[model samples]
Each structure stands twice: as structure tokens, then as C-alpha cells.
Target: MVLVSYILAPTLAFCNSYGTGLTDWNLSSTYGKIGLFIIASLVGSDGGVMAGLAACGVMMSIVSTAADLMQDFKIGYLTLSSAKSMFVSQLMGTAMGCVIAPLTFWLFWTAFEVGSPDSPYKAPYAVIYREMAILGIEGFLELPKHCLALYCGFFVGALLVNLLRDVTPKKISQFIPIPMVMAVPFYIGAYFTIDMFVGTVILFIWERINRKDAEDYAGAIASGLICGDGIWTIPSAILLIFRINPPICMYFGPSASS
Candidate 1:
């Protein structure tokens, strides 16, 4: 499985990096699912679960790292920074993350009801990836009726959309839907989609009011929001660890008495 991952990593990373450049969306987990299916099928049911998960981890790391490095490189290029310095910084960050990420996950896991249906961190992708591994071990014949057909149809449709986008004029291509962006809501639910939509509306209004300012400060504004969201999570997690729940809980659902 390691050998297979090494062999596939370069191509997968290159594709993922290019896609990230185009759409600012990383599909590394999608590629990881492909790895999971392949490795699980090859290992068979006996121990396919572990092998498939291991392969998925290897593939996702390679693809995600490549995409992140490329994005940083793009920033360095725009700011006239040295490639060597950017590479070194990325290496250091990745090394730190290797230690920090798992520990942070452990903190969350201990503090919260992670992966539970009612938990905020439902970890939908983990369930999807595990199901893919099982499906691989069980073989394609186990797929529900018309599921494979639906998959093939969507695959072909995505290819056709890309082809059209590439061949069309810039104005038309700009309006064309990106398959990667579309797939996000399907996998992760529409909550983030709603957030994105709200952001887009805000940006549009800003651009209409002050085009130059919007163009100049848009990246900074977006980065601040993203960083703030991430940083806020630390305090939330710490509060949870201390058993301090928020005073107000908002629940949106049908009433049981209805």
C-alpha cells in the first residue's frame, strides 16, 4: 500500500495542486477515497479496513501538502519572496502540524461528542471514507440499484462541463459551474454553502459600492474571517474542556408534539 501511494502521489498531487489553483478548493479527500477503494479491494476483506485507511491517509497527506505548498508559492511569487524561504517555511509548518494536529484532534475528541449525529463535529467525511473502504472490500456488485449508473453519469457530466469550459470564451467559461465546488455541498452538507453564499453577497455589495477598495482588501478580509473562525475554536474547545457550556442553545427542528 505504501509503495502504491508513493507511485500515485506525484500525479495525484500535481492534479490536486492545479485544481486548487483554479478553484481554491482541495479535493484531496476525494482522491483519498479512490486510494481507499483501490487498497481495500487489493487487500481483500481479511484486513482491508486498516490497509485502506492507511493508504487513504498517505494519499490525502501528499495531495493536501502539495496543494498548500503551491498556494504558498503563489503568495511568495506575488510578494517577491524567495522560493527557498517559502519552501523552508512550509517544511517547518508541516513538521509542526504533524505533531500539533493529532494532539488537537485528541483534545476535541476528549472534550466533545465528536462523530455523533447530534455533535457539531459529525465528521461526515470519515463515515463516507469508511463506507467506501467497505464497499471496495465487498465489491461493486453490492452497490444499490442504479447507484453505479448515477456515478458514471455524473462522472461523464463533469468531464463534459470541463471540456466546455476550456473550449468556450472567457465570459462563458467564467459563468460555468465548477464541479469541485459543486461536489462540496454533496459531501459536507449545505451549511458551508450558505456561509459561502453570504460571503459572496457581501463581496458583491462591497464591490458595487467601492470596487477599488474591494479589490485591494478582499483577500485580507477573507483571510481575517477564516483565521478568526479557526482561532475562536480554540477558546470554544477550552471552554468545553472546562465543562462550561454556552448559556443559550439554538435548536432547529420539528417539535416532538407536532
Candidate 2:
């Protein structure tokens, strides 16, 4: 989404700003390639106090997300969701990304460089995930334990909600709603707020304000989501450390090329 907007916004604004003419897809891909590094950093790391400094890529990645969001809102046609929700979404995405992000790094390192000890594929995240995957207790595999802890919290919270509703019963559940019983709430939900829902509010606002012409609004909202919610996904990649600069460039050895 950010890819599409970062591409189109400049081009459309450029056409309006200048006299250039080009198809939207062409423009988007071009910018996406150019900004891939920044995108990488933001996804890979979300700016921890000390640890993030070592991850230059990840720190840059977080800055890029926040910077782009503020700037994009100027041209953004949809601005319904409050800034607070956007912030929460960013953190939520980061936590979820902490799980999904490493998978990509691992896939590349494990599959392509299998049995190559000195391969450039070994980076920070690759090492961590390789360790974890070997341990077999990380990412989605940890979901059961995560869910159990979450359900414990929810059960406690819901018990309180239930007891109160029994007494007053005037939609006390409305205030602290009983979660989907069969569905079973997960710990991630406690933190995440399940807010792919915010986009609906933004879209509805765009419909009313922009006369239902949602093209730019779509771009704006998407840019917000990517830079906003999708910031730390790449750090998961960087955490793996894929030697973007080949070992040959860094002068390791001849087999490094192989």
C-alpha cells in the first residue's frame, strides 16, 4: 500500500506539479525499488533504545515509517482514524511482525544457502531464527503458549465482566464485552486491538468527504498502514542479516562467490 502511494502520489503530484506523464504502476515499482532499503530498515527494527542502534537498518526503517506518515497525511484524502489508533496499530504490527518477519529471512538463508557455512546469507536475523528454528520454539510454533496465557487473562477479565453483568445486566457486557467464546481470544489480541477495522472508518470518511472518489484516499490510507502498521516487518528480515553486500565485496574468500 505504501509502495503504491509513494509511487503514485509523487507521480500524480509530479504531473500536476510538472508536465511528466507515466502510468501509475511504472512509477510505483520504480520508487519501491529505490526506497527498498528504507523499507527494509523500518520493517527490520522499530527503534529500540540500545539494541536498535546496532541495527542501523532497523532504526532507519522506523524513522522512515514515522517520517513518511506525517508527510503523506498532507496529501492523504482519508483521515478518519485518530492518530492514537495509528500508533497502536504500528506497535501491534511490530509485535506480530516480530513473528512473521523472521520466516522470510530464514526461508532464503536455509533454502538457497543450504550447507554453505561461509555463505553471505548468514546475517543477524538469520542466525537468531536458525537458532530458534533448531530449538523449535519460536514464531507461530509459540502460538499455543501465547494463546494459553492470553486466554488466562481473558478468562479472568471476562469472569469479572460476567459477574457484574449478572447483577446490573444493562449491557454491562457492552462496556466490557464478552469475547467470542468459541473463538477463544489470543494474547496478541489483547495487545493488538484487532484493528484492520480502522481502515473502514477512514474509508467511510473518504466516501463522505471526497464524494466517494477514493483513489487517493486509498493510497493515503495504505501509505499510513504500511508506514504505520507495517513498519517493523523488515527488521525481521534484517534480524536475519542476509549480507546484502556480497561477501566478495566485503573480501571474505573465493568460495564466498559460489
Candidate 3:
């Protein structure tokens, strides 16, 4: 029902910002937790967490597939491509991700001490989901077991966000700190936030300088950047296999690349 609601009314997905603020993470994660709650209620506690995890997986897959379908439809409209061919291409890419994802994970898991202080990618979202599952099983009183201080912080933050949003004008609301932006450091740490800040600064400057051109080309530019980053990862992984670290990493201490 939640999935259908989002499909029919896309704005409903964004409405989560006003609630528990889980939508800040992403639409899929937010809805997955909803599914988790429902599944837990039906299955009872013993297997509820596992059931919730399964529900999260299914919800994410469905939401993501729907999102991808929409994007393909847009591209098909522009290029006049056949819908059948687009569907086949999407399936082929999905199959490739199934194969490549595990091997890529294995490469990183074997190469670095995952979840350690030194690791580059800490898998922060995985930790958040795990904690959410625990919370679903145990409820509010058990908050301290996970991290009571963090939970309290989130609660206070959400309250402030709601209050601020209420008083702020709609025209200026875009300038207000989004609940998701404030919640970032709690989930993924400050480094990712720093990266985001850099990107935001760049966007701010671009929009200020040439608002029209930025509006016109931003979509194409962003798409190219995403694809370029993904393409670069292949070579980066190959370099790792050959024990060749990045040039910048060589300047740092021995453990920097790890």
C-alpha cells in the first residue's frame, strides 16, 4: 500500500520529512522500515527482525525498480527507443549487478579491515539499518542498549525541525537546514557531510554565476559525473588487485590506503 501510494502520489514519499524524518535517508529505506513494522506485527517477535529485514529488501527492490523504470521511460521518450528494448537492457544490467556486487564486496572485505577506523568506506548505512531492526524488535525503552544519547539527539533535532518549518515561509524554507542534512553526521559521520558541503558549495557558486546555464546543463553534468565515478571504480579496483595505491595515498602514512 505504501509503495502504491508513492507511485500514484510521488509527493507522499517526501511527506516523511514531517514525520519521524526517516525519509531523509532515502524514500526506499523509509518505506522499508514501514514494511518492517507491518511484517513484525504479523509474524510476532521471535522471527520479526528477520522478517523485517526481508521486507526491507523486497521494499527497496520494488521502489528502486520503479524509480529506474521512470528514468528509462524519460530516456526512451527523448531517444525514441522501444520500451521492450529498454526493459531488456535494464534486466541485463540488473543481472550484471547481481554478479559484480558480491565480488566487489569480497574485494573490499578482503583488502581492508571493514568497519575499522582506517577503512575508507565504513558501510555506515548498513549499521543504521541494523540498529533500526534492533529498535523494531525491542522498542523505545531499550534505546540505551543501542545508544540512548544519539536517539535523544535525533528526537530533539526533529522537534526543532518541525518548529522551524512551521514558522518559516515557504519561499525561504529551501534555505532552512533539512532534517536529513542535520541527521547525516549521526549516521555516516562528519567526513561524508564534509563531502556534501563541498558539493553544495560548488552548486551554490554555479547557481549564482550562471543560473540559466546551470539549470539547463546540470542534469546532464550530474549524470556524466555519476557514470564517470562508477567507471573509475573499475580501474581503482584493478589497481588495488595489483597492489598499486593512488598517488595521493602514497603521500600519507602506510595505512592510509587501507
- lDDT for each candidate structure: 0.84, 0.44, 0.63
lDDT tens digits by residue: candidate 1, 1-258: 789887998899998998776546678888888888888988989989888988999999999999999889867865679999999999999999999999999999999999999999999988888887888888677878998899999999999998999999998899999886777778767655765676689899999999999987776676565445543557778998999988998777768844
Clashes of each: 0, 15, 0
lDDT of 2 by residue, 80-173 (tens): 5566666666678667867887897688866786445676644565454334323322223344567757757976876776687667756554
Query: lDDT score of model 1?
Result: 0.84
The better-scoring model by TM-score among 1 and 2 is 1
Judged by lDDT, which candidate is best? Answer: 1
Per-residue CA lDDT of model 3 for 207-256, tens digit only, reads 99999988776555644544354435677789889998656733445676
Q: What does candidate 3 score on TM?
A: 0.48
C-alpha RMSD of each candidate structure in angstroms: 7.5, 21.4, 10.3
- How well does each candidate superpose onto the true structure, as a TM-score? 0.68, 0.24, 0.48
lDDT score, residue 141, model 3?
Answer: 61
Regions more than 4 Å wrong, model 1:
19-27, 74-80, 91-132, 227-258
What lDDT does model 2 reach? 0.44
